[model samples]
Target chain A: MQFGLSDSQLLLKDNARKFFASECPMASVRRLMETGTAYDAALWSKMAEQGYLGIIFPEEYDGAGLGKVDLIVLMEEAGRALLPGPFFSTVALAGAVLSEAATPEQKKRYLAPLCRGEARATVAFLETGASWNPADVRVASANGRLSGEKLFVTDAAAADFLLVVAREGVYVVQTKAAGVSIELMNGLDLTRPQYAVRLSGTPAEQLGNSEGLARGLQVGAAALAAELVGGMQRTLEMTVEYAKTRKQFGKPIGIFQAVQHQCADMYLETESARSAAYYAAWALEENSPDAEAAVSIAKLYASDAGRTVGNRGIQVHGGMGFTWENDVHLYYRRAKASETMLGDATFHRERLARLVIDAHGALAKSA
Target chain B: MDLNLSADERSFRNEFRTWLEANVPRDWPEWREKPLEESFDYLRAWQRKLYEGGWAAVSWPREYGGRSATLMQQAIFWEEMARLEAPPMANALGLGLIGPTIIAYGTEAQKKRFVPKILSAEEIWCQGFSEPNAGSDLASLQTEARLDGGHYVVNGQKVWTSYGWIGDWCELVVRTDPNVPKHKGLTVLLLNMKSPGVEVRPLRQMTGESEFNELFFRDVRVPVDNVLGQVNDGWNVAISTLMHERGSYGARLHLLFKRNINRLIELSRTFKHNGCPAAQNPLVRQKLAQCYAEIEIMRLNQLRAFSRITATGIPGPEGSIQKLFWSELNQRVQQVAQELLGPYGQLAKGDLLAVDNGIWSYGYLRTRGNTIEAGTSEVQRNIIGHFVLGLPRSY
Candidate 1:
């Protein structure tokens, strides 16, 4: 019922916000942009040591055993700070997927080490031109082998392991495993290092059957939505700051009626994104029957809002905002990339249309 | 740093949420039967209840018997409580505005006496800043304060003070010198609202509430002890309180939207134009979608403000951004509610079968005050553009 966060959740969130504000600032991130690697390995490890890497998993599996809502809180702060790493994928997708689909033995093997931040993993699910269709699994996981390509994988270049979804089922593919090839791409947001990974008959451990893949993908999508919720928070903050400090026409541009109105609009987008994200995360935690639909709605709005708020950030910053040195670009790129990560707003809208159309039998609600 | 909450803070948040769920009902009271005075009483009683429960001053200092909760915690309290559509509380003309100002600049006696009363809503308060001619140019106010033997005599008129008529006291700005810049030679005073020679004329607003007031002062006299800060230092004090006030009230954008949840549900259930539920209409759906999106961003901005406050101890001028962002959102969201009903929306409150029983019409009229009330939207953008973003300010 707490639409936002609990008091204790706020404490954790503030701690994370303070840590990132001081430790992984935009200045530090800008300094590391061309470093080719997104994350500060030592810092990432420290984050892991803090149990952020396994925020939502089971305590028995060495997790904090906090709910996904709590992780959503951290993820938002992480987004606010633009903490450069494989955090979104590792904490959000891999950990959540394993929790949803993995056997107890699998959780003991992956979730515990992952929670402790000793190992980093990501989901390799979508192929080129395929974004939101979790059922679009052409890559096959059969006969103890995995083969398929996952494009636009965030931080795949620096990952220790990859959890790949395939036609037969879900497969665990290590970055260094045999028959696996990775091409590090020039990402829009250097903070979130992305990759083009091609796996051909890679030695893989199959986690579950096709049904399991379905379940894992849903978890991953929901996690992505939650991660996006975080990113949108950062976008709004950065833009607001930019609006305050950036000046044009002999005074601060935010003082202008037009600019302030635009900022307000952006704020609205980010606010809606927050609600959607929180509701989605909360639903998952509550085990609501409507969790899937809520997750879809959350992801859809967040992706759209990520782009809107991210762009508005630049608008608020104006010229200096468009420059490469500003942290605004960090959020901007992330928003653009993330908007289409699991799916675009339109894609989610289509998905939502399908849901309502199916569940209630098509009432022509679209107009 | 982890984003987990401390067990106690978590408990505080849950308890607050529970309290709001149980005690603070957000339904707009019966307008005619429950007038603005009644509304004020409702709020005052609720504040005392919360103050007794020790939830009233979520962000005030501990010395004042406030919980002085972290910024994020305060924000979390507001956000969660707002989501429940909780009924109004005795808001912080004192706690958020005067209390923080006094903390920063008040004499020990002033702090000891006024702060507690403000927290407990023991005395209702209002601001006497804007004169008929000195709104955006508040520094240009001609409300004169002449220093007499051990007392200051004030003569002036102030307008548009919300929650003003029934207030027990007034935190006001008065001019002490005319031979200086507009912003200089000013003083802030704490005068009894019921003081002799003080008149309060309530202004009924579109929302069927007389939340705004016009105050007239004729030789209002108060001891030197009533001074808030240094003589002729009212501008700085006012600025500080205004910032805190902005931050506190900036959550209004989404808070108002959340209050409309029932209205939205009703509009969805009944506002028919072509045949389908207005909610089913794609345009209305789009409006809802857009409204939903804007609400999310407002929430995120709110979270950012809370996080910043929690992390930094005192929120900086960035509070202006939240203020600016929210004021405009309130304006737009209310517009959506009105437009959702088409021509039927044109019906005023008394019209039959009016949209949401004409609640939205009241809302639309009331929402007009959003951008205007807490500094005009134009001024807010200027603040954000000039102060926060370093953008050019419109003259």
Candidate 2:
């Protein structure tokens, strides 16, 4: 069967590329990073106007009805642009959960504003310990009163709402609500700011049914995988370009087998990441039986590939790559942050191990 | 974007599955027993049966006695065969590589004479592109062929020729003009392996398999009509052959990797590590999980490359990307397998107390050739650097 982007998906990707190239180039990214703004409001509004915020949401909810693949296309562009903001936190993490978990009234009240970009939101899934397992949730919410701290929450300071993972289920709390305090963390990746939220008995509205949170995590992992693909791709391109121009000894560094092979390795990693992310997106869209396994595989590869390719990208750039003035480190920081954001490679690998063991057990019982 | 097979492709798979289920030897696993010659004969007969059943060359055109299947169909065919644990066709080199090249470049008469026998396993073929001196830089080959009235007198030595010991024909590349550039002066000829003054010396590998041989020719004569394409253009034909070899069989290789990982998983469940089952060990589990991820990457890479081919109607240098990934991935898989086996890793295949019949040891040793053969990983990186990334040539 055919297993590539359709003509329309290709068109969407190209348009997204052109949009990011013109609107959110690394120059603007660095500018935003310096000013300590979570994101550019003008660019976010422009993205909303382009209907990107609702690429995968239903039109009845003031959104587009495209599939997970279209979201992947957009997320990839966002990562390439290093668009500093709550796009992933707002649209991918929180939006996916709301779309799946929010009741008709809840969706009308919350998701409508999210799709229209009228309100920004982020999800706080990790406690002090950033465990990927839902069973490891330490936040407690009883009778709409939440008491727990969420660390490494992306765009927490900039969000109007926080979808906190509690022992009971998921709860939505206003960022400025009583007993809710948000502190911006001085993290490595300034492009996407991380914040630690301290909640002490904060009044929260319960999002009915925690069933969708697992799917939400899988969807987020898939989208993040797409973003990592973008970062890896740009890093590889930058490294290859630098190798072609940077001379060593006598000829261009690209002419040297050592540098050439390094770039080739980056090339391999980037391509593999792209394939893994795309397939995971497809699997999520189709609700394939292997979606859980596929999501973990994608995240695992993207994590490893992003870090390896980014580090190698820096290595290929020689002294320039080590300096902040060089853009290679920007990708490197983002890659590192994304690798540890939801869960690192080690976390996902263990999840995969469990899935494999469980499947083996099931097969044995049947036999 | 659907990964599942289309209806037609699924039907094609089902047809082959039915034929294979009924025809496959009941004692196929036992076929790998002592008396290697008898095993080879069994495999040859099985391939002939596949030919008669119309399942020998699924990717070949119908005019050449094949199903003329689409890329998806071809992939499904290979995947199914690998799942059934069927032996590779007796004339794999002939059917997979040289036959496609011949179809592309062979004269009308050449195709008529050569295509049918190749599918039927009547003619075994071996490639003679690499020489002792021209391993990676094949254009530097010193093999020479001079044209006479109706024949070309060839004198050359080729190494690492698979199936050379029993090959019926050799897809030999030679220098036809000494005055021109190395690449421009070459010619490709389908040489009769049984010709006078030809010698094949089987080379024992580290794995103890003599599947490859060294071929020496002293004035070996080949009919001028056996030349697939124009003289002095063998370099292009050789490149095409290499491309086909890499592009067409990726799905099959992916299944082979899958089968190996599955076996390794079963082995992990049984093998002991520190007085407990190795499967329960965190490190071993992580390693196995990594193997699964990498293998999946290999399969996805195949699908992406195959998609590009389907869209463009040509297998471009993008195919080189998968070639570079898979060869290295295969080595990594076998290396991990051997590491998991630990002390048993050193045991040869068919050893009395060996795990999985010591397949991991043999696989570990044999997989070294995956990177060096077809094209070295270094050469593959060069291709990606030059063609895919548009980097300047290192040379």
Top lDDT model: 2
Window of ten residues with lowest summed lDDT in model 1 chain A? A358-367
lDDT of 1: 0.73
Report the lDDT of model 1 for residue B124: 77
Instruction: Please give, for residues A217-292, the per-residue lDDT of candidate 2 as tens digits.
Output: 7889999999999988888888888888988787789988888889888889988888888898898898887788
TM-score per model over all chains: 0.68, 0.98
Model 2 lDDT tens row, B1-395: 77878889889988999998898877778876443446767778888999999999988899888888888888888888877888878788999999999999999999999989998888889999889899889899999999888999999899999889879999999999989988999999999999998999988887777878999999998989998899899999999899887777667888889878877877778788998888889898888889889998898888888888889997888667877888888988998788788899878766897876777778888889888888888999999888888889987
Error of 1 at B243 (Å): 4.0
Report the number of clashing residue pairs per model.
Answer: 53, 0
Q: Write the per-residue lDDT of candidate 1 for residues B1-395, one digit (tens) a residue.
A: 22346687688789888877777655544533355565776777778888887888787777777777776577667777667655556755777677778788988988888888888888878888889999877889999999999989989899999778668888899998878887889989999887788988987766666778999989989888899888888999888878877777766446666656435645565667588767666666655555555555566556655665665577666566666666666667778777777777667666786764676667678777777776876676566545554444556
C-alpha RMSD (angstroms) for model 1: 7.5
Per-residue accuracy of model 1 over A180-286 as CA lDDT, tens digit each: 89898776777787888998888898774336555555556666666666776666666666666666666655666777667665655566566667766776777
Please list the residue runs of candidate 1 whose C-alpha ends up more than 4 Å from where it truly belongs after superposition. A1-99, A104-206, A209-302, A309-334, A346-367, B1-33, B37-124, B148-151, B192-210, B217-225, B250-256, B269-273, B278-312, B381-395
DockQ, computed on Cα atoms, for candidate 2: 0.69
